[model samples]
Target: MNKNNLIYIFIICFTLISCGKNRIKLISENSNLILPKDFKILQNETQSTGIADFEINIMLQFDENNFQKIIHQVDSLILVDPNWKSSNNEYYYENFTNQSEPSNIKIYKHNKTLKFVFNHI
Candidate 1:
């Protein structure tokens, strides 16, 4: 291959690898979880204990609008009453009974941030 062709291939590989390292796949696949695209992801972690058991934790810096949107989407389904930790923060837990995809989700909100924990077993 010519020098130019090799340089182009190297650049493409580097770009894909760099982007993959930072990409969060669950955010796109999770239909039940809705988060604004503008927020900065502070943390994203996933653990798999078995073939069909996994847990995902994500924390983001969001705005008031995003926070309200999440609350509204899950309002009617929150299984556990929200526990207010402080004037500016609270937590919500929701459990799904669908046998095909039994799972639980926890949401916590502080002034301008939200943390989501999702588990499927």
Candidate 2:
């Protein structure tokens, strides 16, 4: 192949690879909140109209320990029941205001997947 063809292939490959899922660390000042090993950002969007708004949705596949850890941390931060536990792939959902910011946080978990959505307007 020619030099120009190789350049085109490289550009295409780079674009494709960059489009893959983004990873992030779930950070918080709350000491009880343990960071998961891997969390993939499924969707991240921002818009500016009459008002500015943004949303981040991340998902993680976890085991029992992770589920309990998150549950306890969220409970302490949001004043919910920390004793709540999951079994038989039950679904859990909660929406609460962000204590440290002007945003809303929503957590949904089912089976082994946990999803967190944060929205600001």
Candidate 3:
């Protein structure tokens, strides 16, 4: 193909691949989650009482369905902890559910942390 044709094709392919809807769909399907408006992510490292030497932090907004599902599956979830002290951990959900307004939820671990801001509206 000519140089111009090749450039046009590349642009078209890039545009198609960069479509926002596909990204949104992938995130939603993979996490069974829906993010709130103006959400953001932050990362950090820290020590924990578990198996891992250090934890990775992931901060974002919360989706109610995903949050509930995660709470339910916490026991079965495989958390990456460097300390390896405990295999099972319990989370307090009543505080979350009883809130009159949605609140930010922070999950900490030896290897990872998740921060989720919940919006009631």
Q: What is the TM-score of candidate 3?
A: 0.25
TM-score of 2: 0.41
What tens digits encode model 3's per-residue C-alpha lDDT throughout 2-121?
Answer: 999999999998876665334334333333334445433453223353553322233543355554555545434324322112224323211234243333333444323345332332
Best-to-worst ranking by lDDT = 1, 2, 3
User: What tens digits encode model 2's per-residue C-alpha lDDT throughout 4-117?
Assistant: 999999999886555432322322321224566554445443333335565555555657777677766666654554423334444334334354223223345554555544
The stretch of ten residues in a row with the least summed lDDT in candidate 2 is 23-32
C-alpha-based local distance difference test score of model 2: 0.49
- Candidate 2: where are CA atoms >4 Å away? 1-32, 38-52, 75-101
In candidate 2, position 105 carries an lDDT of 31
The lDDT for every candidate, in the order shown, is 0.58, 0.49, 0.40
lDDT digits (tens) for residues 1-121 of candidate 1: 9999999999999986665444345443443455666777787776786998877676777678877876666563344334212223564444354444433334566456655555666
User: Candidate 2 clashing pairs?
Assistant: none
Candidates in order, TM-scores: namely 0.48, 0.41, 0.25
Candidate 1 least-lDDT 10 residues: 79-88
Better of 2 and 3 by TM-score: 2
Native-to-model Cα distance after best TM-score fit, residue 113 in candidate 2, in Å: 3.5
